[model samples]
Target: MVVTRFAPSPNGSLHLGHAFSAIAAHDIAQERGGRFLLRIEDIDGERSMPEKAAEFRKDLAWLGLEWEEVPAQSTRLANYEEAAQYLLHEGLLYPCTCTRKDIAARNPRMGPEGAVYPGTCKGQSLDPDKPAALRLDVDRAMAGLGELSWEDEVGGTQIADPRPFGDVVLVRKDAPASYHLAATLDDAADGVTLVTRGEDLFSSTHVHRVLQELLGLPVPTWHHHPILLDEEDEKLAKRRCSPSLADRRAAGEDGRALARQLRMGEFPAGITQSNA
Candidate 1:
């Protein structure tokens, strides 16, 4: 059976952008006569609160989005760990301990070099007892990816040469598995054959695609749809920037209203309602 999923981090409440992606994935999978699953991305221990995760699920249910039951990503680290170890054993990953400053110095064009990472420790060693993140050997993975393209139902065919990303961190220096790692593993584990997400994550597909090849897992069909922006025309965040989804829902904004607003080709406002 074909499978698809709407996996979200439990760091914040579901927002209008999230609602758009969720509806698209669920509706597409249903139309294709496939299964739609929900996986709580609770990998970030510090920010992932049980209450917040509950609010995400509650909000989705209220919006009438259904899913096949699984506990959550926090409960499923065993799967990710096993996959990471498989890659490690296959020599697909290396240990990295580069600091933010070290990475920024290497690639100025790299966005927010603080996060782009120079892969300083790709071949170096640290105290075995000291903490470190696992970095993927991207050049090797690129050689593995070769030239492959997938057509999206909504976004169109996306192509890229996966040679420049360099070795990226699979595990964060301070966190276990980063979003790309966990997400790739989650899709593989759940037998997902289709993936529909926000266009903001379009570049993220390269990272996931590499991981999928390195793990000997099948890469699913990808559809990166447009995001629903707020009045500020900015991506939604739970931080000082965007309002929380729970707050919006409590104010009585519904998904139907959001869909209509976006379909009408409305641009988000320059200034949004103040959360503070």
Candidate 2:
């Protein structure tokens, strides 16, 4: 069966960006006869507040999107740890103690996201008691991946070289799995087959693909969609809260009003009673 997800971090409220993703994933589920899941990507304990998660849930429900159940990252920590260990056991992961300054000093040129990790301490001996983040060996995976291309729902076919992402951090020193690691694991665990999110995340797919291969999971097909940008053409951050969902609901926002604002343009949507 086809399964898709809108895995949002509960670090902030649902804004225009959230609604765009919610509708995109929901519409895809409808089209594929699939389940549209809502997974909380709150791996960072410091950031995830109970009230924020509650508010995020209410906001999505108010927007006419529903899910199977709430599977939180903190509760699913064991699974992430097990996955990390498995990668370590397979020699796909290595510990690095390089600080941010060390990384930039080694490689000044950065990719789209930021400075490509220089792999300074990649092969260096480290104290067992010292803290370290688990990093995926990109070159090893790249040898298997080569040049890859994915189909985007909005932007058409895309090709990636995979050199820029370099080695991505899978697990932080504190054992909180990075978003790339946790999302791939949760998506596979939830049996997510089609991933629908903003185009801005397209670059991150290289990291996800590498981990999927390292972990022996079948990589899901990607459909990176258009982002809802602001007047300055910057990626909209929920902190602005200009056309806030809460404000909209207070002003009587419902499915139709949301659709119009989101440019989803009314094709019949609801909090449908489905397996999702």
Candidate 3:
């Protein structure tokens, strides 16, 4: 059976961009008579609010989206740890003690997530007791997997090139699992067949594909739909204080109507759509 999921972090309220992504995944699953799942990405111990996850379910339901709820990432820490340990044991991961300042001092080239790591701690013999984040040896991983590619519903077949991301951290010093490791493992564990999200995450998929190969996880097809932008043509993000779906609901706006508008590519005033 085809399976798709809408995984959202509960650090903030759901906004229009979140609605668009959720409706897309929900509709796709409904149309294909497949399963639609909801994953609460509440692994951020510092920022994740338990109450916000409940709000997410309310918002999604108000939007007329139904999904099979999966256990939150917070409840699956051991699974992520096991995956990280496997990668580390296989020599595909290394512990890095580099601070942000240490990376900046290297004058490293910029990638999607700021300065690409210089691999300063790639082969460094460090004390096991010292705190360190685990980073994937992307170069070595690709060399072992050889060339790889993944299919996109709209973009067709695309080659996976994770070199630009450099060695991304799979386990952070502060968190049990980074987004890259947690999401990849969760998708496979949940038996997801299609991954759906905003187009802004397209680059991240390359790194995810590599992780899937290294961890021997099943690869899921992806559908990166357009993102909603504000009047200034900036992508709507929580950090920017975009108006949330809950706020509109509080104002007595009909959520089902909003979902229909999003489905038809019609957005509220001051909001626009962009493939970027």
Candidate 1's displacement at residue 143, Å, is 3.2
* Best candidate, TM-score: 3
**lDDT, candidate 3, residue 108?**
100
Model 1, 180-256: lDDT tens digits are 78888878777888888877777778777767767778878888777655555666655634655577678887745
lDDT of each: 0.71, 0.73, 0.92
| Candidate 2 local lDDT, 50-73, one digit each (tens) | 677777677777877767765777
User: Comparing 1 and 3 by lDDT, which wins?
Assistant: 3
Off by over 4 Å in 1: 111-115, 253-276
Candidate 1 colliding pairs, count: 1
Better of 1 and 2 by lDDT: 2
RMSD of each: 4.0, 5.6, 1.2
Model 1 worst lDDT window (10 residues)? 267-276
**Residue 177 CA error for candidate 2 (Å)?**
0.5
